[model samples]
Structures are given as C-alpha cells and as structure tokens.
Target: MRFFALVAASVMLLAVAAAAAEYNVVDYGARPGGRADDSAEAFLAAWAAACNDSSSPVMRVPAGTFLVSQAYFKGPCRSAAGVVLAVDGVVVAPSAVDSSAWIMFHYAHGLKIRGGTLDGNGHAYWACKSKTTPGRRCPHGTTTLDISQSRGVSVRRLTLVNSKNAHMAIFDCTDVTLRGVKMLAPRDSPNTDGVHVQLSTDVRILSATIRTGDDCVSLGPGTSDVVIRNIKCGPGHGISIGSLGGEAGEAPVRNVTVEAAELTGTQNGLRIKTWGKPHPGLVESVTFAGVTMRGVQNPIVFDQSYCPGRGNVNCPGKSSGVKISDVKFTDIQGTSATPVAVRFDCSSTNPCTGIMLNNVNLTYNGKQAKSFCKNAHVRLLPRVAPRRATAYRPALPCQLESRPEIRLVGLRLPVLCLPVLRLPVLCSCYACPSRASPSARDRAGDPTAGPAPPSRSPHLLVYTHMLVIYFQDILGCGKFKKLGLQNEEALQKCFGDIISVGNDHWSPHMVHGAAAASPSNAPNVDGNDTQDIDIDLTQDKATCEEGDTNEVEQISPVNANGKRPPRPAPPKAKKQKSGTALTIQEAVTSMATSATSYASTKQGKYSIDEVMEHVIACGATYETNEHFIASELFVKKEQREMFMTFRNNEVRFSWLTRKYMAKYGN
Candidate 1:
C-alpha cells in the first residue's frame, strides 16, 4: 500500500507540472537581430508546441528584437484551457513584405495576446507609393496584426506602430475585447488606420490611444453592438463608421455606441460616410455622446456622398441609397477648425433621417459655428449651439421660417409666405386710374370713404408680376388667367429670358377680352366704389360661383358705402383635448392604411395641413412615423411640399415603417 501511494503522488505532481507548460521562441532557435536570422519559423514552432499542449500553455518571446516576415498563427489548438501569446520584446516586420498582414491569427479561439510591441516598418512602402505615378499602382503592404475568424479574443496592453495599412484589424470575429492598446503612425502615413473592425460582433474597444493618418477606429459593415469608449485620437481621421455602400446587398450596421472620446486636430470627429451609389444597406441606432473635439475640421459629419479618389475620376454621380437613421449626437462640445462645424451632406435619395443633436456646443474661432445640412432631417434638441444654415433647399415657392410670435392654439408655428395668393386679395381694391370711372375717382378723394385705398408700391407690383409669370408656367396659363392678373405682355417683357414659357396652349388675347368684360371688375374698373374683391383663391373660377355668397358676406362685412369693413382677425384654433393617443404601433398601422387609401384616390396629393395631421396621427416618432413618411410616403417630386411642410413642423417618423407599409398597405 505504501509503494502504490508514492507512485500516485509522483503521477499527480507530473500532471500539475504539465498543466503549466511554457514554450519559448528562443528554445526553438530564434535569434535576436535586425538581419542575422528570420524568427518567423522559430515563432511558428513555438506556437505549434504551445497550441498542442493539453495544459494551459503560454508561448513567450523574451526581451529582444526579433525580425519576422508574414507569420500566421493558425489555430484549433489541443489546449482546452486556451493559449496565451506573451511577448516582453519587440517583433519587427521586414521592410519589404508581400503578404497583406505581417502577423495574423486565423481561426484562433480563446486567445489572449498581451504585452507586445509590433513594428511594421512601413516607411519604405509609403515612400514607394508616393513616388509611383497616378495611373500606376504599388504594393499595398500589410496590416501589422490581424485576427480573423476568431472568437473569445482579448488583446491587452499592446503597442503597435508605423503600419503600412491598418495597425490592427479585427475581422469576422466574435466576443473580442481590446483594452489599453496604443497605436502610433505618422500623420501623413496614407491609410494607416489604427484599428479596423469589420464583420465582427460584441467588440469592446476601451482606453485606446490612437494617432494615425486614417481613421483611429473604423467600424465597417456587419458590425453591431460595439462599445468604444475612453479613446484619445489625434492627427488622424477620427473614428468613422464607413466609407461604406461600395457594393450592393451589404449588411446593416446598428447599435454602435461611442462615448467619452477626445479628438484633437483631426480631420473629422465622428463621421459616417457612404459611397454615392445604389446600396440597400443601412446604418442605424448609432450614438456619439460625451465626445470632446479640439480644433477638429469637421466635428460632426454625415457624408453620404463620399467620393474620395483623386480628381474624382471614379466618382459615382448617382445619389447614395444607404439609409442612415436614428443617430444621436449628444453632449459634444468643442472648437471647430472650419466655420461649418457640423455638416450633414446626406444622400438626396435616402436622406439621413431622425438625426438628433442635443447639447452640442461647437465654436469657430471663438464665435458661433455654423451647420450645413443637405437632404438631412435634423432635429435640434435644446442647447444645440451651432446655427443651421439654409442649406436644405426645398423645391417650393417660398421657404418657411419659424415665427414664434405667430401662435396657433398657443403653439409657435412656421409662417408660410403665400404671397401669390395673399397679394392679389389684398390689392384688388386699388383700381387703376385709367380703368376707374369718374365717380370712383371722386370717391377715392372723400375722407369719409374711410381711407383711400393705399397706393401700390412699384416694387411690390413688379414682384407680384414675377410671381404671376412663374406660377403661370407652373400652374398653366388657364390658372394664371384665373388669377385675374392683367398686363401679360408687360409681365412677360419684365421677366423676359428669366421665365421659360412652356405652355403655348393659351393665347393672351383669349383672356384679355374676358378680363375687360368681367362684371366683377366692371365696378372696380369704373371706380364707382372701392369695394373688396370677393374672389376665393382656393377654388377654381367655376367653383368660386358655387361658394355661398351669404357665407362670404358674413365673413367680409361691407358698409353702406359699398366699402368692405376692416377684416376680422382669424379665430384661434381651439386647443385639442389630451385624449389617449394611440400607441406607436397603432398609430403607424392606422396612418399606413389611411395614407394608402388617400394616395389611391387622390394621386398622393395632400394639403400641408392634411399631411401635418397624418404625421401627428402617426405619433411623430422617428423610428416609427417620421422615417416612414420620409422614405416611403411623400418621396415623390409632387409630394415634396408635403415633405417640407412636415419637416418644418418638426414632425418625425420611423424607418421601420417601410416593412410595415409593405405588409399592411401599398
């Protein structure tokens, strides 16, 4: 019994010793030198032994500079406890390498890489490319460290420098964490991105300091649930989501959070760029918060029309189709190197929607910065400092400007300038002296005729004539004549080449006789009385006669002298009762059906108020309602006014409604 116990104790001790095995590269004939010997074989041998060990194995590189050439550490190791690659020395890549990656871990799982300095030695490659002619291409060189098709990977406390391309790339991996990783490259080093993550999930990059020419951290397509925090980036293109949409059927990138990042003197801080081509991919639910930018050229940017080739030789003229929505930029305060600090040059086809800017204070040269938005629906939360320029040019006759003093039901409203409709109604009573009769001219001199009709301003008349000619081309000559405008030749001469007359169906002589003989104008032409013209601009000339005259008399009261009394102020709209609003799903479903029915019957034409009510009924949430309207409905050129109206009213919707509409309505 005593002899058996001694043998068992010896076996247990041996097993314990095997469990903590270590494989050293030096033991595998690795020499420390710049040119004496290549250490790639020795490092591979060490990794092979460590990986096959059933124990918790570690492959170690001691305190020396080892030169390697395109080493690949392939995995599916026998070690159940995983393998650790710990280096206390420097691993240097040869100046002239052919492979795309200097050191790559392929299909590696449960891998931990800690405490290494990787020197890419990329100066030669960069210099070679710089000397190459524009038409010619040079060797693209390699990424420093790449981990592909791996899982449960942790890279910590590593310093990577001077990479020919990206310093570190995480591709097609899952459950990866990079902590305390420092990457350094010259500011002028082309395409030296610090960390590039693509087709990966659950990636956490924390406490990283990156200085490079390209993006410090870039998240490509199919990347989701990424958390990037505590990053210090400078002299680089600050963290970017893309230059995506280069191909069709790309996967959507969603649920990315980047917070507590500081960017200094970078080309851009927090940018999402997509190519100007047709792509079905989208970027959604991205949050950039608590970011501090110092002298960044563009603090916040969504460049959907990204054409980066020299001379734009390969530029795609078509608008981008990638949908970017529900992106929030919060608590971003900094100084901008350029005056336009915040730029949203989104795609005209798939305009960036549901963009919220909250508590963003960006300054340009110690003064207020400006924001430029094109085809982007931006919602400014309280305390957004950068003032938006009139960059979003809507295809409408007049741009709506918000006038807080103009209230409807106690809500501040944007005042739409309907000068074409209002000017004719207000100035109709000012009869021409040549047209008016002698009695009407005498009545204009009477003090008791209230005040003589105010003389028309020459400038106003010219402006009105221009508007008439412009709308005449748009609404057709029939509608133009129905506006009761005279002196068609004068207006055509005044506008001359500026107005393109597309409608040749109606002759000016056809309307001139009617204008001269109309009973409504006879009294005004004779100048017998300064009576208000009761023309209903909203109705057609035929429909205007059908309108109740008694209702018009009640609305516009006339005195005994045949002069209209002072117009009564418009009645305030009653405040709506706070009834139980429908849930987002209910609102969207109801609105989808209603919009489809309305579109089928009316050719999708809607009044501004009708569109506003539709958006309101949809509950105004970007993800559910606003996105639906912007992307699915109101996207036609004829519906553009409705789109602009809803945007001016600050009504929002959702992008998810596309599918909902597809399922529930046309």
Candidate 2:
C-alpha cells in the first residue's frame, strides 16, 4: 500500500510541472533568421505544448529575425487564461506567400498577443504583381495578420509594415481591443488596408497610426458597436463604412463612431459607400466627430451609387436601397483640396434622412467650402460648413447659441424648446423680409406717400442687392441668369432669386411698366425694402391676372405723383384660447419644415421674401448687413419696409408654411 501511494505522488508532481510550463520557441528548435517552413514548424510545436498546459501558459519569442511561412495557432485551450504570445522578434514572411495569411489565429478566446514587428516583405510580391491580372485568379500575397472567430482578444503595441494586402483582418470577432498599433506601406500599394473588421461587434481600436494606400480602417458588413478613437491617417483612404451590399445576403452595419481623427493628404476623410445595386440592410446611427483634415479630396461624403467596375461605368447599376439615416457629423473642420468638400449623393429609391451637419467648417483653396447635395434630407445645424454664405449659421436653432436648457427635436428639421418660451420652435428660417407682418408695415405708414427723405439710404439697398446677387452666382445659381426677364426683371430676379426659383426655371420680377425693369435703374425702383410687400396667402396662384392691371406687381412702378399703390388688406388673425398669447415665432413654426426640409421638398421655388417671412416670424434675427446679403432680408426694420413699399403681397411658400401658422398662430 505504501509503494502504491509513492507512485501516485510521483504522477501528481509530473502533472503540476506540465501545467506551469513556459515554452520558449528557441528551446523548441525554432532557429531565428532560418528557413521559413522550419521556423514555422518550431512555432507550431511551442504553441501546441503551451496551449495544452493546465495553468495560464506563456509562449515567448525573443529578439531576432525569424522567417515564418503561412502559420496558424488554433485554440480551445486547457488553461483558463488561454495563451499569451509575447513576441519581441522581427517576424518576416518569405519572398513568396504560400497561403491566405502569413500568421493567423483561429477559434481563439482569452488570447493576448503583444509587442512584435511583422515585416511582410511586400516589395517582392509587388514586383511580381500577384492578383494584378485576370488569369492569376487566386488571392496572391497573404494579409500580415488574420484573426478569425475570436473573442476576448487583445493585440497591443505592434508595428506592421509592407503588407501584401490588408495589414490585419479581424473577422467574426467580439470583445476585441487593439491599442497603440502602427501600420505602414507605400502610399501607392494596392489593397493594403490598415485594419479591416467584418462581422464583428464590441470592437475598440484606440491610438492607432496608419499610413496605407487603402482605408485606415474599413468596416465591412455586420459590424456594430465599434469605436475608433484618436487615429492619425494619411496617404490613404481615411475611414470607410463600406463597400457594402455588393452581394445579396449581406448584413447591416450600425452604431459605429469615429472620433478625434486627423486625416492629411488623403483621398477621402469620412465616407460611406455601397454598391449601386439594391441592398436590403440598413446603415444607421453612424457618427463622425472631431475630425481634422488637411488637403483632403472629399472631407465628408456618402455615395450610394458606387460602381467602380469597368462594366459598371456605362450601366452604373441601379439605385442602392440601403436605408441609411441618423448619421451625424460634428466639429469636422478642415481644408479640402477640391471645391466639393461635401457630396451627399444618396440613393433616390431610399432617400437618406435624419442627417445632421453640426459646426462643420471646411474650406477649399482659401474659399468657403462648397457642397453638392442630392436625394438626401440633411439638417445644417448652427455653424455648419461656414463658407461664403455666413447666413446659414444664424438660420439654425437659436437655442444652440443662447438657450442651453432647450433641447432640439426632429433630425431633418430641428425644433427646439426655448427657456423663455414654452412651445417648441423651428430653428432654420431665412429670417427674410417676407416674414414681416402686413400690419407692422401698415402701422409704419407709406414711404412713397412723400418725397424720399434725406436719411433714407437707397444706395445702401442697391449695394446690398448687388452683393446678394454676387453670392447667388457663387452658390450655384447660374441658372438664374438664363431665365428671360423683361420689365422689372432685374428687381424680380433679385427678390425671388433666393427662393421661388425652380431648378432650371427662373421667376421674373413683377413690374407695372418698363421704367424700373433695367438692372442699372435698380436704385430708382419703388420697392427697395423687402418688408414693404405684405405676403398675401389669399391671392390667386398665378403672378399675373387677366388684364386687371390692378393686380399688384411684385414691385409696383411709381405713379405720375411718384406715389406707390396701397397694399391689399391682410387676412384676419384667428383668436387664441384664453391664456398667454403665442408669439409670432411660435405661430409660424411649420415654416421650419418647409424652408429647411430641402431633401423631399424643393423650397427653392418659394419666393425669398416668402421664406424670409416665415423665418423672421420664427424669431430669427437678421442682425448684420452680412445676414441681409445672405438671406436677402435687410436687418433694419425701416429698410425692410422700404423694400416692400411698392409691391403686391403673395406668400409663395404658404402652401406649406400656412399649415403651421393655422395650428400655432394666436
């Protein structure tokens, strides 16, 4: 019995020794700076022994250059903590890659890999140009590191360079954290994306510096809850949300945030692209904030009609139906190399909505930034893309600057609750002259009833109009000139140019006779102030009526007495419920939807004065001359009355704006 007990004790000691083993690759016959296949076999042996150990085993590779062929470390380890691979050496791939990944780990959990230099030796493969031709169909050179079907994985402080394809590909992973990693490749290298994530969740990549030809970080299908912060990307495609929906059975991507990134000399700063074909999944709740760009081609973009293949050039596929919404861009300041700093070419079939641009200031060639928007509903928040037209800033929700307690509601059109006022108010209004109430002008008396006063500055009004005209051309309004105008055409063009112009059709200025029609005689025109015109919603739809001649022209010509005609009586106001009366801003709240909802509705066809009326009624103030130039709404109350003094009152945007007025008006 004593002999049997002694034998059992010996066996227990041996098991404990195996559990606590630390297998160094050098001791396992891995020769540093040796042949590829041999070194790989040695690494495999070390990993196999370490993975079987009962305790948390560690495999170490000391400093040296080790040539390793296509290798994989698989896990379902006996140890609770799995394995820790500490590599201080330089790992080199052979001149020709033999497999899809130079170093791969599969089905691993509780795995940690730290401190290593992965040299892909990609120059040799680039010379041979594998996968460069049609006949070479196979995936040529392998990605530097590939981790598949892994969880609880962490890779820290690794330097990877010259990858044949992507530097790292993480697939089907969760709870993955990569920190302080650096990746580099030639700026022109093809397909060498820095870190690619697909079908992954709960992934965090922080403090990464990537300089590559492709996207610094590319999120593929089924990636969600991913955060990428404090990244520096240059000489590459900055960060991309997809090339999604290429296939029929792809998944959705959501809840991705990219913050504090600096992108310099890159093709794109922040982009989301999908195939032009119909994609069923959605891409939503993606936010890109606090990004700085220098010399970037397209700082912010969304391209749903992406078709890059040669065959697709002529066909360009169909409109992509990937439901993309609730995307916000905040504090993205930069200088763009191209004039088109922002291009939102969304799919017509699934028009993008709930898009917000907040405090995004981008410039091109020392000029204010330019944007081309199509088929998308976007809210230009306060201080958005401040360029040549600074007026866009004041049009945003007033609460953003003054009232902190007020919260904004609605994504396409921002509505906010004012602390001083209880009801919600729309933030975006041109705050132009048309919004001035007819009663307000009537109380001030007529400017044309007497000779022009010495204090009244018609010259300032003319200069302001000229400035507004100049800005219209700068803001993609070339089509306005092509519209043929006759008498009072110049004034008609000025008053309606900001709004009421169709995409191609132009509105002619309303003039009684040919006297005030010419652009040169603009200063002598009867209506120089925008508020002089009362916006009458009850008028006939057409600008001209059959020979009534009494139909008030937009700018009525001066009579032989040098006096202007009286404006028609305005509609009566509805009585409010017994209590506090609603302010004019609260009454005209719906104008926010009509004026700012440029995505679905074409508000440009509404008269500038009409849109301005709603904006002004909404409590937005045209406090500066620059504001007047941008909105075509003079700030001075007297000036506004002067501009509208000689015209008929027609509310062009009333079809939509009046609905809100009826609901909220006092």
- For each candidate, what is the lDDT? 0.66, 0.63
lDDT per residue for candidate 2 within 347-420, as digits (tens), equals 86887888887777788788655565556656654442223232222111121111112122221211121110
Per-candidate TM equals 0.57, 0.58
Give the number of the best model, judged by TM-score: 2
Per-residue lDDT for 445 in model 1? Answer: 36
Which window of ten consecutive residues has the lowest lDDT sum in model 1? 506-515
Q: Could you tell me the lDDT of residue 186 within candidate 1?
A: 94
lDDT of 1 by residue, 24-52 (tens): 89999899866558999999999999989
